[model samples]
Structure formats: C-alpha cells, structure tokens
Target: MHTSEHSIMVNGIPIQEDDIEYASRSLKAASHPLRLKIMCLLSQHEMTVQDIVDHVGTSQSNVSQHLAIMRDKGLLSSHRVANRVYYCLAESRRALLQACSSLR
Candidate 1:
C-alpha cells in the first residue's frame, strides 16, 4: 500500500483522496438508523419533513434534527416549497445511495 497527498495506491490501484473523504463523511452521517431510513426514503423521491416524520413514525422534531445533521454533512439538499421544506439526497451522494440500495 502506498499513499500520496491526493490519493492512495492499493494493489497498484489508485483511489482519489477526495472520493475517500466523501465516502467517510457520507457513511458517518448515514450510520444512524434514523438517518439511514431517511436516506432510503429520499432515495425514492424528495419529501417534506412532515412526510418523513409520518413515514418514519417519529416526532417532527426528531426528524428535523436528523435532517439538519444530514444537511450539515452534505449528504442532503433541501428547498422550500411554500410553507414546506423538501429534502433529497445530494446529487454527488446519489451514487452512494444507489450502491447501498443495491445491497438490499
């Protein structure tokens, strides 16, 4: 194994440092069960906070906190629609979600 400032070489294959960092951050954010559930839900389509709370059978406040964490970690993106906030997996993280879904 060999490492450089921008990449790592394992078995003669180089992996970009940025990709590794992104994977680390995304995995950490989604490691929580509630957050994982939210990601799986959003993998299907964008949803409002209330919708996620209803589907996850949790309190709105609980859902909001999880959403905030995921948002801060760059695993999710959100926008306002009138009085509602809709959230979806970040574009860069969608491939990660797809890879996880394939395991199910």
Candidate 2:
C-alpha cells in the first residue's frame, strides 16, 4: 500500500490560513508608534503602568489604552503584584518583536 500526505506550503514552508489572520493582528497591534515604543521598552524588562508612563513620556490614560490593545492582541502578558500591574511581551512574541526591532 502506498500513501501520500500533502500540506499547504508558502515559500517551501507549511502554513495555515489561520496563522495569517493571527499574524495580522499582532502586526496591527504593533503598527502604532506608541505601541512599538512600549514593545521596545518592555522587551528589556517588565514594567508597571506608571513605569511605562515615565519612560514613554506620555499621559497615563493614553498609555493604558495602548497597553490594553497590546494585551488583547496576545502580544503582552501582565502580572499583578501588590498595588501594581506589570506588563511584558509574551514569551512566544519576544522573537517576533526582536525581528521587528531590527527593521528600524
């Protein structure tokens, strides 16, 4: 008996259509300049909302909104400690961020 397996491929690499939608969301989440800046900062270390506001030189409310978007996109993870919440790039997204940073 002979059997064969076939898979959809892109650039010689197998890929799923669903992956494109997910990638698009991540890319769109990082498209904003503020979000990109936040990603760069978070890439170094996790930070509280206030720490992000201080480093990014933006209003807390604006920073919070952007953080929410990134968080929703699965690009970032958050940890709550005491009265503060810290945010950082999700482990899986870190390499994607590194590739993005290199583009600049």
Candidate 3:
C-alpha cells in the first residue's frame, strides 16, 4: 500500500468511482465476524473445510455456507483434493486478521 494509493479526491470532494467501488466491496466482505475469522484462519495456511469448522465452532453446513459466501465475494479460494477441499486466503496479509481476533 502506498500513501497516495488512498488519496480521497480529484478536487477534494471524493476519489475515483472505481476506487470507492473496490473499497466498498472489500469492506462489505469483511463486515461479518465469522467471515473475518475464516479469512484469518486462511491467512495462516491452507486448511480443510472441517478444520475451519473445528476451529470456529460452527456446524459443517453453516461453515460451508459461510465459506461459500466468502468465496463468492473473492475473500477465499478453494482447491479440491481426492475427498476433501482445502482453503486459504485470497491474498497474504497475516496482520489483517490480528485486529479481528481481538474484537471478541
């Protein structure tokens, strides 16, 4: 990230439309607690769907549903193994999840 990367204005009113759109999408995807946790877990290393459920203490179906949403939103990526799927962060930013962990 660069200091000028987040510049908030053309003439001081607001930034480019596309920048706002991207930021809005990113923030919205990060809005949920569970989703945030999932991202955090993935940030560390790849894990199976079951591992996420175990660490987050949620039902398999529920976790899968949440993961689906995150995947759709571009926050998570998945790969299929022989009998299971693995997941990881879409990008590498270990520190991004630190703040989320302390919130609760």
Candidate 4:
C-alpha cells in the first residue's frame, strides 16, 4: 500500500478525532500576539516565567495567565527544575514556528 493509504499509529493505536479537536484549539491559542512572543522567546531556548514576563514587558501574573492558556490549548509545555519552571513549544509545533518566523 502507498504511504498515504497506510495509517500511522500512536501509543499502539491509530490517531483519533480528539487529536484534531486539540489541534484546532492549539491553532487558536497560537494566534495571539503575546503568545507569539512567548513562542519566539522559547524558540531561542526554554525560559522561566520571569524571563518571559521581563522580555515581553508584561506582568508576571499576566505572563503566567497566558502561559496557562497556551498550556491548556496544547501549544506549549513546561518542565520544572528545582524552583524554576521552563516553558517551550510542543515538539510538533517548532516547524510551524519556523515557517511563521520566515515571513519576517
């Protein structure tokens, strides 16, 4: 069978409709300006909440709020190292970001 005719498997099962639902939500979350800035910052390297707030010229709580929304929508992820929380894009979205950045 052609590659297009074959199904890709995830976690020993085929991908489902719910995955598409999450992608739709993630696309919407990624459309915001501050969220884009956060993506750009993390593209360079993962960063802490304070780093994002400082660079984006927004309040820490505001940054956290945005981060939380992005996290919920499946556009980004966080890793905790001791007291610091580092955030980065979902591994799959990096190419999307590179494409978006190329427009500049």
Q: State which candidate has the highest TM-score.
A: 2
Error of 2 at 99 (Å): 1.0
Candidate 4 residue 103 C-alpha distance from true site, Å: 2.9
- Structural similarity to truth (TM-score) of each candidate: 0.80, 0.86, 0.71, 0.77
Candidate 4, residues 29-79, lDDT tens digits: the string is: 989999998998888888999988889998999999999998887778899
**lDDT comparing candidate 3 with the true structure:** 0.78
Off by over 4 Å in 1: 1-6, 9-15
Write one digit per residue (lDDT tens) for candidate 1, span 10-96. Answer: 788987768788779889998898998999999899999988988999999999999999999999999998998999999988877
Model 3 C-alpha lDDT per residue in residues 3-35, reported as the tens digit of each score: 665767765676766766865676687788888
Check candidate 3 and list the clashing pairs. Answer: none
Ranking by TM-score: 2, 1, 4, 3
In model 1, where is the ten-residue run with the lowest total lDDT? 1-10
Model 4 regions more than 4 Å off:
1-19
| Tens digit per residue, CA lDDT, model 2, 14-98 | 7666887898889999899999899999999999999999999999999999999999999899999998999998898897888
lDDT of 2 at 49: 94
lDDT for 34 in candidate 1 is 93
Better of 1 and 4 by lDDT: 1
What's the residue-level lDDT of 31 in candidate 4?
90
Q: What is the C-alpha local distance difference test score of each model? A: 0.90, 0.90, 0.78, 0.86
